[model samples]
Target: MSLALPLQRTEVLVIGAGPAGSAAARQLARAGFDVLLVDQQPQGRDKICGDGLIPDAHKALARLGLLEQVMALAQPVSHVGCIAPRGGRIDVPGELAVLPRRELDNLLCQAAQDAGARFLAPARFEKPLVNEQGRVCGAQVRIGDDVHEIACDWLLLATGAVPKALIAAEMCERHTPSGVALRGYVHAPSMVGRIKAMEVVWNKAVRPGYGWIFPAPNDCFNIGVGVTDSHKAVSGKGSKKELNLRAIFDAFCANYEPAAALMREGKLLGELKGAPLRCTLDGARWSRPGLLVTGEAAGSTYSFTGEGIGKAMETGMLAADAIIQGKAKQWNDAQLREAYEQSLRALKPKFDLYQRANRVNAAPWLADLLIWRAKRSPRLLARMSGVLRETSNPGNLVSLKGFSRLFLE
Candidate 1:
């Protein structure tokens, strides 16, 4: 059963008030646009994530003037320790930060509100309202029992991966090698002293992707595993019911003596949540006249490190800039698409190349070899770190001279 509704108007409508949507709304509102941000969840909603923000992510937030607020709630991480399946450890010196997604998202939304963007939380989005020509004019939203049609000049979809509305409208195509991420927060006994670092352990049992233990504030930590669906099928892990993440954590603790000691004193703080990870670059279509998509809705996440915060912020900012310029100039779909694609190319090539390399080197033996080489050679380590940080151009991959210099010299 469907009901027709009267129309409301706004200058800009941003869907999904996550990091990407909030960032876009904040920038657009600061630029003097009347931005209306909407999300299905209520305020202070929690998201499932490792909550580890790398230094580059901090840099992006600093540009948006939200660094101080984020720092206030975040726990500093000064090192990243990795344990290989072959039983060797490598410690890298760098700064990272962690905070629960609840705090971070709330802070970002507050910032958006302060910048003059109106928010409609707990507002369920039914679908995009497409014009006769198929250009999205706004969205059909349900607030409580009533459905309202919102009119806008532009619609930005910052909705994350599971955007059923967009998929139903045939605006997005799904592709991949999808995977499952199981995450939870727990209290563990202080191992390796204080909780100032994030630890990644690559064990045989954790295939395709790795397991991570990231320190959160107040002696709490986020523990998670990312494993491809195909890997799970091959491993004969029955079904999701039989392969619960909490059980996997217990198994890991049992197998690893050090981890076992930590769990003995640790408390299981909450219910574990499972989320899907799209492993391929599937959704690349961005604009159709009045419609534009950014962040995970556009597949801006890097498949390699599972890091989307920085990329989402970057894309959101670029989208705002493009929208402002396009609206002012009355640009067409081709023009907007060109601008958006250029923005993605500018901000994404290095990270995309890194993801490609990771997919190519998916085998544990190859990963072990690369890690060993990186650990042994300072220059290689620096180059790898630079790639990870997205501070270098991926064009270096095509340059024979640069490749030789990086790996051999």
Candidate 2:
């Protein structure tokens, strides 16, 4: 594709209107750059997520200057209810809230537009346009039946999880998804006030996976299950990993009483939906000449909690910062890529710890151990809360040292 007589030109083209893309676009546009934010779907599209915003998310929202606004629209909660196999339960205190993606994403996208970024809807990225020098100069975007070449100095791919967009950009390193998740909203008025915390449930029946019930605004409960291969599934050594997400979801609804109670008392708002997750910060090449990958396209989700909203926004801001700094400092593309990748390197250890924490999902008994210890030891419970705050390491709660600390410390 050629950029000759291109009708659209932007200094930065951010694909996808999710938290990451919107956040990046907002910052770039606020900095007085020509930014164009596009997404295949129209505004307010429902994204598959647990809808729980923990402390880490709070901090990110605060930095975006949207914490107060989001909290006003969110279901503010003080704790996360963690349930173990055999039904042991504990509420870990932290800064937490629930807001549906349908609302949260649109709020961020609108914020980007308000910040002077041009926004386009129903725009799909077909493929990148590479210059003669092998640098990405633009992309071909499909809108309805017509396709247009959009020229840009930099492209940030924030298209989450689905690999087709990544493949088109040659950014997809692995075709296999890091994990899969299922979720649905149920309108349970009776349970709305009753279920206070964002509840996470672990059990053997959903090995390599877990379940959650987050109370949202308007008496809606977000309930779901997920299976991830951050480390290994309960599947034996060298075994092919296959998953039936629906079956696992069904198993979760059956074995977990909270999910069952919610479903029985409330009607499902829509069908249970599933989406793939790219995790471990290992799904794609971080950067190339004139282009950078962020968000779930860069594998931003955590394997342990399937939490990515905050990290997605963080990486988006990081990407915007890289471009801004590169322009101001007159740095080369290599420097731009290095700065972004190094920033991610600082975050990769946390992603690793989250992946290590996935072992508890595989071995549900570990949850029982932690809950058992946490109930007796306020110190242990505080550490778990610190994990939500990103002040403590998640791996410590699941490691051998973690296990020893249950008895010793």
Candidate 3:
């Protein structure tokens, strides 16, 4: 039976109830805005991701006042173990945590509810609704078999990488700077001794990408592989032209010693699944009048590590801040635009640093050399660690000046 919903109105309509939407909704609601958060899933669902929370993620959660809740559910990790193509390993010290997205997303949504945001689950976004002036004023959504319209003063899209809604709304022609990534869980309690931290492995075949084994709560490990869209295009001809990320992941487990060791004893928890990783901070629109795009939908993932959760949440909060600031002064759309763009500018330095890391990954030899250098250079290792923590930029490690200071000096 089609259950029709009544006409709904909200000060802010946040589409997608992931970290980005939930965070934005929580902030805006707490600040006295009537926020409506929606998602297609009836209950919080698991997503294909490493699910590791580095220091920056911690900061974003803390800002949303849900850090303590997340920390309680996460498995603590203190270091990152990086493996070069030739089997050389380097461990960088930092605080890290991993929690399944199923749990994390639910907790974030509950937090948003507690802060006064109304939630509409199992509601799928159809498209953006624009005013006569071509300004987006709200969204069209479908719940079950009934379609409904949600009118809002502002619309925030936290839809994450794919850009289906973005394209439907005429926000972009298509997604640019995208990559394919695969992830799955494995139950390996006995292998915990060898896997004490997040492990990242690089192989010659998976240039411009890498494989990861992140320890999760319980005896599970999130294992995955990723490769950029550009890398896949130039990979080869014929059937080889299409890059099989799963095959790449399987080959990585077979070749990488640490990963191989775990797979031997660990049982697969579920089927491995893959998705498009929307990265590289380019060619995505952030705002169009009453609407704003935050999170991966706005290209917030760091190209260097393919880490999106933290940046995603950060962009959400930034959008909320801009909205709150504009509301205070009753600013016009032009003013809101300025505030939002100003907020996005804060990420430029970090994004630039990630771009540099992308270049390093393109040249495997240089990245491997840097990994080797980190094994012997404490200063370099510390700086590398700081990049993950958001205290240092990745560019500092690969820049000519930084290279000279570390190796030549």
lDDT of each: 0.71, 0.89, 0.82
Candidate 2 TM-score, true structure as reference = 0.96
**Lowest summed lDDT over 10 consecutive residues: which window, candidate 2?**
231-240
lDDT by residue (1-409, candidate 2, tens digit) is 1223338898999999999999999999989999999999998898999988887788888888889989999998889999999788889999889999999998999989899998888889999999999999999998878899999999999999888988898887777678889999999998877789989999988888998899899889999998888323232212227678889888988998778889899999979998888888986889999999999999999988999999999999999999999999999999999999999999999999998998898889999989988999999999999899899999989888888888986
Superposed by TM-score, candidate 1 places the C-alpha of residue 223 at a distance from the truth, in angstroms, of 0.6
lDDT of 3: 0.82
TM-score, ranked from best to worst: 2, 3, 1
lDDT of 1 at 81: 70
- Tell me which of candidates 1 and 2 scores higher on lDDT: 2
Q: What TM-score does each of the candidates earn?
A: 0.87, 0.96, 0.94
Residue 103 shift from truth in candidate 3, angstroms: 1.2
**C-alpha lDDT of residue 93 in model 1:** 60
> How many clashes would you count in candidate 3?
0
Q: List the candidate 1 regions with Cα displacement exceeding 4 Å.
A: 1-7, 175-177, 192-195, 228-251, 392-409
Model 1 C-alpha lDDT per residue in residues 11-103, reported as the tens digit of each score:
899998888899999999998999998898976888877788876678779978999889888888877776667766656666578898899
